[model samples]
Target: MPIRLATTADLPAISAIYAFARTQMAKDNNPTQWGKSHPPLDLLKADITAKHLYVIEEAGNIGGVFAFILGEDPTYQQIDGAWLNDQPYGTIHRIAGNGKIKGTFSKALAFCEQLEPNIRIDTHQNNKRMQHLLEKNGFTYCGIILTEEQAPRLAYQK
Candidate 1:
């Protein structure tokens, strides 16, 4: 799958993936995470315009999405746990995936090939699937970060 920057026009697809993510979060009883605010339409649009969204595509279909930012992740900076590495690095945020296709994690990991080594990311405490995926794909459990909503999230880096 090829990963490219996503546009505002991709909102529908991205929203659909968030809906799927909500279902998963609900099943895990994480009612405060993506389960609470889905589609994140406004945030989506903002990220798109900032040129921070990335999409994985194959056969003309979008499969996964990721957004990242540089500098200190405010949420991350306040974490109670220690970071695996203190080195400055890019922070990968909101990696949403549509169950419509597999290999989303692999596609996300491939993003690493384009940048520096110390990449950071976080997952909902209840997002077991993502936690496992990150671990399985070489991400080390770093610590936890509190979201703007005041929810604690498990953090990782690779």
Candidate 2:
């Protein structure tokens, strides 16, 4: 799988993944990080237009996506616990996998590894699957952070 910068044309595929994620988030009883209004096609277009989203493609199909930003994340500054890293880090938000697509996490993880050594990701406190995945992939528990919506998230860093 190869991860590439997303384009406006990828909105439909990305939204599909988010739909599945919505169900998972609901099942986990976590606050909707993306909210019901997210992936508004227009929002995705803007993310693509600004080059903030990346997609994983395998066999010419969109398999996974993760929104990320370079440099220190403002949210990190407000961590409720000590972060694993005191250095600069990249922050990954809204990572989702198309349940119909295989190798999703593998692809996204590979993409993250290629970006930088210092990477941080957070998941809703109820998102046990994601937290486990992050730990399995070498990220250490960092702290909790409240998103823009004021939802608490368990943070991890590598």
**TM-scores, in order shown?**
0.89, 0.88
Where does candidate 1 clash, by residue pair?
none
Model 1: lDDT to the true structure: 0.79
Q: Which ten residues in a row have the lowest lDDT in candidate 2?
A: 30-39
Worst 10 residues of 1 by lDDT: 30-39
lDDT of 2 by residue, 76-103 (tens): 7798898876877777877888777766
Instruction: Tell me the tens digit of each residue's lDDT in model 1 across 1-158.
Output: 88888998888887777777787778877766665576478888988898888888878888788886766778777777788777888888878777777878777767854665688888878778878898988988877788888877888888
